[model samples]
Target: MGDDTLIDQVRRRYLEVNGDHPMSEADDVYVREHFVEATPEAMALMLEGRLPLPSYLLSDGTPMVPAEHGRLAEIAGGVDRLHDWFVAFWPDDPATAEEEWGHYLSGQYVCLTEVSPVRIRMKTRRVAEASVAVEILRRDPHDPIGRGMLGQAVDGVLAVPGLESFLLPMTAYDRLRFGGPTVRETWVEAPRREFLTPVAPVWPLRTERLLLRPFRPGDEPALTEAWADEDYTSLLLSGTMNPAEVAEMVRRRSEPGDGTFIGLVAEHDGEVVGDSVLILQGTGLSEGEIGWTVMPRHAGRGYATEAARAVLRLAFEHYGLRRVVANLDARNDRSAALCERLGMRREVHRRGDFWSKGTWTDSYEYALLREEWLAQQP
Candidate 1:
């Protein structure tokens, strides 16, 4: 309830650590305050109980209940599943569901389904609610039907039986959505800059538990083992290849003048645990693509993360590449999570982009710019 924004706190902390050091202000403190505020401002009203809250909060804000929600939690353990859910969406911060509960929880949050965290059975509720808030905000801002649906939603909350004061916020939001009277487009200007191109891919990268270096002919066996498993191949663009085929691939990539693709094998304790690739894209060396395959036996050990991150460092810091990207099979949650962990943002999710393994396959495209990559580094 204080006026101190997150930037103010950060600035104060910086000053404390720097012994009263002076730093030039980018803009007025008032102008910068908005940047530190919690996003989707409208949702914060209901979430914090300033406005009426609805009970039926879907995970994706679909406005319906999912039958298997509780069942999936039962299968995966409530705490662990919730933690994974949070980490998958927000990879930069290492905090889990339990740690973020106080930040998202408000007394007005209501429960409609037993499977949902709204039932107050676990630490996952606040995260689920926050996710719902975000999803709801993504709906079309000017859809006429939205007014009808949201009106129905408002009536559905009548069961909560509160004072009439909260009704005004709902009506106000409806006006904002249906076309606020003051709504109009405004033009703003920004400094123009020249287009920048990044450099070439660099070499042997190191991580905490993994040493990522160029693939050797001797790596065919380990690489084949990792790529041949059914569980692994079933999620790849080319599904279910045999060990022999994977070995041939290793040989092809191992050959000289195969500068198009560079294979980096992930070595941990002298054992091959995974393989990551950096593929130069287009005639221009400014863009690069990445791919990874980790051994089934080594799953969940963070080997994929270490390998991907090291290669990313090479692509950005050493190679001066402007952009690095990964294309992942949509069903491969682990790979998608690894991309997120590498600070890559999901830019595309193409539906059924290809047919593979006896079914249509979708793909997720994640990317990071050189500037973004640099910001992540120490």
Candidate 2:
């Protein structure tokens, strides 16, 4: 028979004998040379625990199967191995090597046992050989039985030299019900240093006819003018703000704290026409809300809409809010319209939710999730 026919005959015969048994050493070598290059789908099949025995015979007539093929097959069939494959290959492109490593490390399916640096060859400073040995125990990190196995694997790996550097933080595992030491204690002896220096908030979000910025001391005149306007006064908690009160508001907003309150003033041709505030909800929730009001003259120009979008962008991108919510009077159609235009959904409506204009007024709640905001981004 021809080479191709003979190879096919051998593969069929081997499968008939072994059935679904794990791959042998000769099987691995054959796969690397022939199947890996010729039949890439074999890798996926292998990962799924289906090892296709090669049909091709070795030049010396020995069967083509590697010794460790059986163990490799077992590992590949596991959930952790499947997760590692996805982490290594998926997402089309990875930004950095560390990020790629993070993809595998952060996976809920993979149970990492060890990650150690192995020096292959020692030479002069300019030339050396090195490799990383990452030994992992296959288990579902989210499952109870699997989680227990993962803990033992992690502890075993930590005892090995060079593997402790990649150990998961205790707090992280604690949250997930898996345990380990702190990253600092495991990876480094010294305390880590912060890289980015703090800075003041940048402001003055602008549009065709409006400039939105924080309320400064000198903005008292504009604040008094805008706050005293009937259209603006009716929308606010308080009707008016004196110079001292305005100054205090500005000072309090400008001061740095665990949370931030940014008071924004919308200006038209050097005069304040509207105002908005973005306050970080400091109750340990990772979110913020926007409160806004516009003068009667600027009401129909979409300035509030423009400013709110800017604030939303800032909150979603810089502040890292998973969700941002806005609470407005149910009767206030203009504010609700602006929120709707920005893709915020009305999630709640409370009857007699607030005491406004001396009587209880209904409140309409609107919110935009981070995923929604990201989808809307250019």
For model 2, the stretches where C-alpha displacement exceeds 4 angstroms are 1-201, 204-209, 242-244, 257-259, 282-285
Candidate 1, residues 308-363: lDDT per residue as tens digits?
88888777656546688888789889889888888899999999986777788888
Model 1: residues with Cα > 4 Å off, grouped in runs = 1-203
TM-score of 2: 0.46
lDDT of 1: 0.51
| Each prediction's TM-score versus the true structure | 0.46, 0.46
Clashing pairs in 1: 198-320, 199-320, 200-319
Worst 10 residues of 1 by lDDT: 184-193
